[model samples]
Target: MSDNITSNNPSLEDVIAEAVRSGLALVHTSLPGVVVSYDSSTQLAMVQPIVRFRRRSTSTGSLETYIPPPIPNVPVVWPAAAGGALTLGMVPGDQGQLMWAERSTDEWRKTGAADCDPRDTRRHDYGDAVFVPGGRGADDPLPADAYHATATVLYGATDVLLGDSTATDKVALEPDVQGQLDALAAVFNAWIVVPNDGGGALKAALGVLTAGGWPTITGATKVKAK
Candidate 1:
């Protein structure tokens, strides 16, 4: 008699349960991954899945260990619509989530067609994975100095451009601007511009009375970017 259960077997429910488990294992959804490398030009990344695949071996009744190979050329997700996009600088060792599309994305990726059909009947394929970067461990929290109560904050780089990428006007640093204004005010206060038509001697300069001195123009302490 064969050990494998058939449709006429007494324990039919056991076969059905095992079949469901095997099918569910093949369905790829989402998993945590670490970025191995990123290509900004192509907006693609090489990601190493963080989860280890485990399955019980029938021969020895032991769990088999399998680490998924690094996935390459995975598209990185960015917030975009219409003609505008917000792109981020993804780097190595960045932790993120990997999501597999419902169908094969080969045709869609290659042609950028909205109504394109899958090249094959593959579903929830690992090859169609896209990365969403920004996930971090709870123990490794963001720096306290970078946190803001209400306003949007940008850390690391400070110099900012408000217009197009090629725009020449860059926002000046607050401290630098303040220093320049202070210097100009000092020079103006000292200069004794006496319009002389053969004057005898220079008198005290006409004082430009300010409320106190140069008003302090403080810059945004919370938000900054480059």
Candidate 2:
């Protein structure tokens, strides 16, 4: 009877393997994706999964084809804590990772409540995905800075905003520093007396120093800081 069962169900192991694969396919988790679109105001994105799902081709049963659907209304993850948040400019075509919530996020997403119950019973659904930017491939590596290396926060290809300041102040960088220095130099240059003038040497020197509106630090308008 045992021999007959073994002969009759020779593909039992294959059936079990297929069942495991099918079960794993139902589990929604994290995967690399590309940004289709992002709304900065809402902090939500539409992402297309980079990794494709393999399915048997309808035309050819022996061949497998790839399927990648774009996920809509996914929240973009920002670095936030203690009342401060760091946001990135995620444009279309930017690479990222999509991580799905363990439970339904519909209630929490709408209310932003700490103790909200799931509106739906769906667990690990793709609709609850959150996008985290900067998931780059090995081919598309981050360029290292000469001085700061990988520690630098880069804006575009050239500009870099280094430090942050209090709400009232800004951490001035680059051309602003040069402009301030130039203004200071102008003030100092004015104090050099030219030996003879209509007034005394002291008065002439003082007049030159105050020629440019009391030697104020003027115009450094294009200053941007983190």
Candidate 3:
């Protein structure tokens, strides 16, 4: 299966992120077969089809504008001005963090916070220090075959990741947990086993860590770990 977040290329990442960001809620759609209601507190609207728009560049970035293209696809979800242009790329937030936005009044206005998707399967993190427990010296690395069953069970690692496209669903571990996993890899006999999904795997692993014991994660019951 193709991993959604399997690349570290910034350009490619932007494309995937754009695809996900374009998912507007199907709310309050008069379109047939898309029955949804809108709340007054909500502001997202569907893009009015067939609206002519032109793209422009801002001092900071670029976006498409429909302000002069103003027209209503419907009453509840009116496009800003003409039709607020969608941001050509991500935007920066008030705090200067990268953000996602929708068009409003000839401007790309952000209704909420946006951040980069840091998940990438083709990346590996080799921490500063090596984990070579009981080795002859700091320089003598452990053999890949030397890790025993006890070590594997203790660290919960049974597979090795080569840090490539094949290493799908890599986990972005928290600092403390990452340290533990790094050290564990030295003794656990191979590269650490990561979850085959997104942050949910990290969350589940965190649950196990906070559970005060090594636990079997049969289902989603392990996501509550602190």
Top candidate when judged by TM-score against the true structure: 1
Task: Give lDDT tens digits, candidate 1, residues 1-226.
Answer: 2233433453766677766766777788999999999998899999998999867677875557789899999999999778777665568998989999988899988998879977699988778899998777888777876679987865544333333344444445678687857756675667665566343222222123233343444455433334
lDDT of 3 by residue, 68-172 (tens): 221222123222354432111111110111111121221112222254333332222111111111213335545656577556521222433333224444344
Is 2 or 3 the stronger prediction by TM-score?
2
Runs in model 1 lying further than 4 Å from the true structure: 1-10, 157-170, 189-193, 197-226
- TM-score, every prediction: 0.72, 0.70, 0.13
- Cα RMSD of all models vs. native, in order, equals 6.6, 6.3, 27.4
lDDT of 1 at 88: 58
Question: Could you tell me the lDDT of residue 42 within candidate 3?
Answer: 41
Badly placed stretches (over 4 Å) of model 2 are 1-10, 57-63, 146-203, 206-226
Candidate 1 vs 3: which has more lDDT: 1
Residue 118 of model 3, lDDT score: 35
